[model samples]
Target chain A: MSWSKAMPANPVVAVAGATGAVGQEFMQVLHDLDFPASEIRALASARSAGKKIEFAGCGQVPAGELIVQEMTPESFKGVDIALFSCGAGISKEMREAVVAAGAVMIDNSSAFRMDEDVPLVVPEVNPDDVSWHSGVIANPNCSTIQMVVALKPLYDIAPIKRVVVSTYQAASGGGAPAMEELYSQTKDFLNGEELKVEVFQHRIAFNCIPHIDVFMDDDSTKEEWKMVVETKKIMGDESIAVAATCVRVPVLRCHAESVNVEFSGEVSVEAAREAYETAEGITVMDDCSSNTYPMPGLLAGTNDTFVGRLRKDPTVEHGLALWVVADQIRKGAALNAVQIAQLLLP
Target chain B: MSWSKAMPANPVVAVAGATGAVGQEFMQVLHDLDFPASEIRALASARSAGKKIEFAGCGQVPAGELIVQEMTPESFKGVDIALFSCGAGISKEMREAVVAAGAVMIDNSSAFRMDEDVPLVVPEVNPDDVSWHSGVIANPNCSTIQMVVALKPLYDIAPIKRVVVSTYQAASGGGAPAMEELYSQTKDFLNGEELKVEVFQHRIAFNCIPHIDVFMDDDSTKEEWKMVVETKKIMGDESIAVAATCVRVPVLRCHAESVNVEFSGEVSVEAAREAYETAEGITVMDDCSSNTYPMPGLLAGTNDTFVGRLRKDPTVEHGLALWVVADQIRKGAALNAVQIAQLLLP
Candidate 1:
């Protein structure tokens, strides 16, 4: 029943939905991280089968092509680690098959994220949570993953009391099709052509959409709900209060957040800056005078979470605000999942 | 000294910086509102002199064209209301001249906004503040103007203790040149050509720049500072605390705000919606199921402040959160100034 028993030196990594955006990132991250994988399988829906995914391999991993195969229960028969980003429903349906095949599911979907038994892991924030996983480790939501990664070091300096985050998320968070939609619509906007709004509810090119995901009964979008709940679970601090407003912008790849964190004790801007500087997987780009701050356009393909705009929120007693950005597909989903798999290595 | 004494059936109006974006909006708004102007003078820098500005007349105001004149102190000699959108320095230099010419200067520049002697007005929020003006009434910052208009209605329901606002501001808030830069840069971005970041400090096409204006010693941008100070001044409440993160998006005209307001007393979402519904110069657009929310793409050129995404913020004792959008050039600048001019009329 434990994940530890199935750990392997050269794990058989299977990427479900390999033809999709986050799925492709899973392959790229595995190659970039030089993860020790004896075999890598690219599994997708029947429609995408026979497609080829290029792996720009690193270290011992050979640079080669992975032909997409149909995803079925038999796909996980020999896999040690199964990375799932197909969808929540697919993840739920395939959970038992992957577990029955003795493979740990590092899910990018929201299916098992809130499950008490399945540990939601952000490697930098809570790698130890991976140790308790019963064959499944959930990757935190993209926005929550980046925010928590930036806040972890600060939280260590002084316990976080509350967090107010407003996200400037990119179209990539909606998947490759959404990114393409943004591109086509923007071109249409420039060409004096009528825009198509199939993927998104409204025109997203040259505009900001405040609604992301379905609206909950309380009026907060489900994306906002994920940030609130996932942060508490991942940080293992239920007492910490979180309020989020998730808005989708026209950027292609990275997600940027304006976070206001109020601490239990006074944490100076100097101390917070130092903590971020020393934190793993965080690049501090906060020199105000030089105009050195993270923009999504610049941080599109970057793995590290860029932190900037560090200042005091004068409204609260011990409040510090920061701006955080990261490539949503990489560190927010695929890379974090790979890191969790790394944590499970024997 | 009362503005009541200068009330005329047909007053002479002069628009300083008439060649600029906001100044053009000044003419459009004046015509649209059909202000009883006996004469309309288009005044700009000497380089723009002799250019013709056509007025699409409204109601009783006849359609005609005015020849752009070189802005000089003498230009305001016979003017009753001088609308100024010239830069801060010009506003400061021309303040005395406009007043000496026996005219009320409804200044759009930040030069006199924070001055204790000058009234910073949003008309809907602080129209009476204009009464104490010594021949000059300052327009609030664009981002601040929309936010205060949305908050004023909610604030009347219960005193606001603190406000956390994150703005998705358009390029027009930066002026006409900034909007042009967005257009050109977006075209460049689409064409795979080098993007020119001249008007703004960074590439604003398909990107969100956290740095709006020059950064201060505390690392907050000048635009953020304006929102804080101007909100306090316009609301006429020094006790209310405000924290703002102003980001420039790729949108052309309207500025949107995600506001989290904490009140001293209980305020339900229904009550807040009702407050915005009954409030003047405000429109509520909060039907989540129908996906009817005010977005900048649909709100450009609108005069009324749009409020939507109404929900209760559970983080505080009595907190409510909402989304606000308004045409940055119209209600945020020219329309607000014209409204102030309307207040001066009998």
Candidate 2:
């Protein structure tokens, strides 16, 4: 079921859900990466149709405004790559049409992530997973994408046995409206007005919510479950056990994770640092003397997955602990999707 | 040597570092708990000597302003219990004077915590640890205090083999000035002004700092080290291993922890919930169906250690995960100290 036709030298790319947060990031990342797109079309729901979105041009596309189009089956007629950031329902609704139109959909939704024929890919970790994709290439969860980017180098060093992670996620992971809620709620909180929480389960201003996404039947949030199952799928290691507690903090953009990894054999802090230093798409920001580490507030628009606070965990026989941070919208979402699109090039 | 004389029914209480954050909380908690203090002396350094602090009526002490006194060696002459929240250096300096004058020093600093003679006590977890204290009984670190409270009830159900905890600590844990910094910096950040970070190493307005205290030689922060050592000492189980990554979050008060505990035996989520329901000084707030879990923003000023998000971690055998939150100043500091004082009563 792999792609039968070779992708053109310059693909006609469609940015689905263009008016949304990650959709905008998708356009920016394509320009930043200098992706060779012959024509770029902005597609969204009927409500957002005709909205003008400014685009910094990339490849053959001119630098100007892109008029939003209502996404429909005919929208993908000449599209070589459809970058989907719409919800899962919309993605599932348009999947067959997208495939039949001879366009490869790199989906940001969770719809086909666990499907047997669909490829769940993090370009830095599993770019080869893109080769076998049957029309739809699933982008891993934002949290899982950054984690696996940081974990791949380590996994190459030694087989990881288990991971215990607790995330300090950002509002950006919830999309544009959630970020707006954080901004307005913060203003209200500071002004002594009662905070109105509409986008989150509770007021996200100056607070930490232990729940992210919907709660699963097993009491783990859907986001937490995604990290567990996605890591196994993307890393191509079913034996690795992950216990995740995903929490949302008030930070507007970058998501940080405190990860403790236990390997099948000894992997020293020095070895891990060296692995990260040479690893693709990973920047090491660990230095205790200078008070330097990757902070979420200051790392909003970065592409690399930043790793820091590397130390040994004496509690386990073969363990190392580290802190990871990356822009949830950039490396965690948009940049990773763009990288996957890069792998689809001829 | 343990206290030689029996404590009077109404002890003369001294609030050292009276002008500091935890010192103020100590006073509030004393009144809140209706502690039987015959006379409450507000003691501070020479700079704050003449300042007055308002005290609510409690026991023999009347509701009025108590003039602060300069803390000299003679300050503990008639004091029966000296609740010290001053820095570790000052606590060490005043330890001998308070103990020589026959007053038990219940210190909130890290001064004598690891000292063999000083018994680190969390009253609910190990009230008996106070029995053999040689003059000074140490209150555990704020992060360690809440975690052990949550762990105690679970441990009672089964022996915990290991614990991996990541803390979302509040600005209040840094003292009064830190809370002030969070308030001002957040305002400054919202107003588009450069954040002034004085109390913390970096901007903590909407960021998470992985380093809490000074970094140890092994690269783990001192705050993380305290959680590891203090938990073993307070739990009276040197066999229990702990790995902690402590981070400072933007919340004004109340520290929240994501704890993953692996027990030596099977402990179901139902069994763990039952243990927490009957556990003293703990409140279980877990209900995924109703979106009910303990949140740091809504749970300020609470004395109980709030436990929620209870679930099974299939990653390991006999594993259970939970989220714990407590007012860092109350149960983590002042209230816990007062509870220890209650243990010292005749």
In terms of DockQ, which candidate is strongest? 2
Evaluate candidate 2 and give its CAPRI docking class based on DockQ.
Answer: high
Q: What is the iRMSD in Å for candidate 2?
A: 0.6
Tell me the spans in candidate 2 whose CA falls farther than 4 Å from its real position: none
lDDT of each: 0.90, 0.94
lDDT of 1: 0.90
Interface RMSD of each: 0.8, 0.6
Q: Write the per-residue lDDT of candidate 1 for residues B297-321, one digit (tens) a residue.
A: 8888899999988898998889988
Evaluate every candidate with DockQ and list the scores. Answer: 0.85, 0.90
Instruction: Give lDDT tens digits, candidate 2, residues A1-346.
Output: 7779789989999999999999999999999999999999999999999999999999999889999999999999999999999999999999999999999999999999999899999988988989898899999999999999988898898999999999999999899999999989989999999889899999899999999999998999999999999999999999999999999999999999999999998899999998988899999999999999999999988999999998999999999999999999998888999999999999
Q: How close is candidate 2 to the true structure, as a TM-score?
A: 0.99
Question: How much is the lDDT of residue B101 in candidate 1?
Answer: 84
